[model samples]
Target: MQQRKQQLLRRHRQRKRVALLLGLPLLFSSALWFWWLPLPLLLAAWVLHEAYFADHLFYAPGDDYDYRFAGAGVSVSITADGRLGLAQLEGIAEADTLLLEVTIKADWRGCWVDPRVLIDVAQPHDQQTFERGCAGRRVVNLSGLGPALAAGQVRLRGRYCRLAGQATLHVLRNPDYACQRMLILAPHADDAELAAFAQYQRGAEVTIATLTVGELEAEPYQQLGLSAIEAARLKARLRSWDSRHAASWGGVPAERCFQLGYFCMQLPAMRAEPLLGHPSKVAQTGDIRPLRKGNALPLPGDVDGQPSWFNLLGDLRGLIEHYQPQVIVTPHPQLDPHADHQATTAALYEALAVSHHQPQTLLYYANHLHDNDRWPMGEQGEGVALPPALEPLTVAGVWSPSLSGAAQIDKSMALGLMHDLQTPLPGKKKLRRVLQHYLAGRRWPRWGVDEFYRKAIRRHELFFVQPWPIKDQAQRPE
Candidate 1:
């Protein structure tokens, strides 16, 4: 409340400053000739001064926060700290990475100063800074945070701040991203998990990859009126968020995961098809990918100027050749809804066919295809049912390992770690509604969130396999 009062004072001063700037020029003219001009000028100043009262920022905070930094102009939280510090977090000390969850309110109509997370690392006396784009928020993990935690180098010291925004912090608990020699691919950041995380365990090598950078070149952010710099920063931040997702969820070493860096929302052009309506606007612009301070660009051979379809195919082929994964899991090309998802499946299929190591198995998953279904997710035919197009694929066997209750918690943590991507934008109203019901299931102990996750933890994760053709489902982990 005190801080808000201060911000109000500052805003008042700022408005007054602007009012003075506008009025002084006219008043000076009036002093010289148009004395009556001051009357209208003062009225304009008053109108502007009173306008600030209507600014609207609102958000929900968790139990961890004791204060409400509620305001208009885009910030609402139940758990916000005045001094900016970590919330009540425990059991995450064992995690290689941790996610700090928060909620935010953005103006949705103007440029917002991207929120920043600063972490003070131990012994090395180093500082890592991350920009958290203005959405109902999520924490930015510090560079080397996972290794630092695993190595017992230091306890993290953190703070959050954003210009033209307000944030409330929450917690995404411990995630054990364990795997050995497992390679998973998703067109988007979270898809890898939703698509393939049904059967993961620790103590194995794991490599996770995303086909696109997951920034629709900030089309949504721009629609929300962010500046170019702000948009780019958000893209880079999202990349970082996915990087953390790999480390924390895949339980693989950070270097093992990779992003293919395709321009988002524009894959149709690569498939010899028209661009999606959303990304079509940026199809011609070569600068859609985020170019951040530490982020890298695609190699010349992998992605051409506009990142064509052939380029995506080449990259997927190269990745398969390099990883030589025995079991390749990806989306069912014929069933997914998003253009990029379909493209990824197609590219992966082509890459595998063309690659030297044909791998032991090809498991095709279909989750996004059923989003609009009335039954919701987490079933073989109802929530997570396969499209008839993929009926022949998983006919051999589905390798869904029974997730122990404890394992379920770990999966939840992994899913929670992905809160950044899960945090919805105005455009994701439908998704939010789904999640709301999903979360409600957790509360009701009915066919809900628990049931949804139970699908992944089921006795088998459904997949289509052919004996020699698909190589007889890759040896399932015991």
Candidate 2:
């Protein structure tokens, strides 16, 4: 795979050089006579870019914490012909749920066409994709194969893709998602919906606490002819309102959804000086003021609403003490590259330490992964596998709660309620955007490629179950 990638890179560079050599003179001449000629050339250039760089079809295995913590229950080896595999369940008791991890090497053809591997283990058939051309280790949930799997051995017959050698399979127990009370910590308003709308929609007592109203990116409201500050304020208020409505779609009421008013992109600065308040650059407001009355935890008399790390942690501690949630869902600091997300989890840990509240489970999610936005590698209503193995994955086990088609539609509708998720009017650049999507073999504004609708509204939502009350932590992982 590495050699094939290198070869493709060399060919891509060669193609670029050849195109430039022939196209520069044409562009110069076209500028003088045919103004429209540059447009076709531009479209051609975009085509070349999409053909070569659009899909990332490479997978490097991250730290397999699941296997490291829970040793394989059964290791199945494929037959010499790569058509059949077998797993012997000896001395194994009855289990409710299990996770099957498959290690595969993607072929060069994966670059042009997305690779889909179908594995049929007796009763239920499952399909797994090497998302974004990744072919390291992909896990599938084995739900109904309970007592039959523990009876004895099982034969695994599946259609194989391009395989170099025998595939290795490890069957391990999946994490439990049972919780009495669940609290989701979202960096922004839509984040809770993106990561765990399905999780809370049909579960025990649930509360969503949004860290910020996500008012920083006011560019979308520029069409409304509002000034930057006014637009930011409006964006903040509307998204805060949208959060309650969106959470309602997930069965969480307005009273249960709390918006901890903090400025976007200011968490890192607040983390540095916990006592100092950080002002919003977009809204031009410095105070930590909730948009709606009684929509947030009440601050102490001495501690007014000021956007500071101390206040943020205080709110988190207050929630933890008040709700006493068994499951706390937040972003993984290491995997998520966003500064606000990292800071949100960091504050949660500090609050946990100060409050000394040990939740039974900590569900960590990563909405912002390494470069590629189009991950899980398929259309909507498809199984959402693990994200690209860019960062060292740290989790006790993987939990992928399957959502019905109706649930997926509800998630899509919930995501659509967010003003930020709506596609902005391309205006003058509309033609360029259309041509780019057309040449890339993609449809525009049908839940934009990077939106939560495409990324989150899937057959299942994925979460990494990190150990609760991390022991001996000087600081969160870097």
Best by lDDT: 2
**Model 2 poorest 10 in a row by lDDT:** 57-66
lDDT tens digits by residue: candidate 1, 201-317: 453666676766555456556656887656655665675466534555545555666666566666656676423222323333443233212223343333333456665666667
CA deviation > 4 Å runs, candidate 2 = 1-43, 55-70, 79-87, 90-98, 119-126, 131-160, 163-178, 290-292, 300-302, 390-394, 425-450, 472-475
TM-score between candidate 1 and the true structure: 0.48
The list of candidate 1 runs beyond 4 A from truth reads 1-180, 198-200, 217-225, 228-233, 243-245, 273-306, 370-394, 424-460, 466-478
Q: Residue 81 error for model 1, in Å?
A: 56
TM-score of 2: 0.80
Candidate 2 local lDDT, 114-206, one digit each (tens):
566554445434555554334565555444444544553334433324433343333434545644588899999899888888878886699
Alpha-carbon error at 359 in model 2, in Å?
0.9
Candidate 2 whole-model C-alpha lDDT, 0 to 1: 0.67
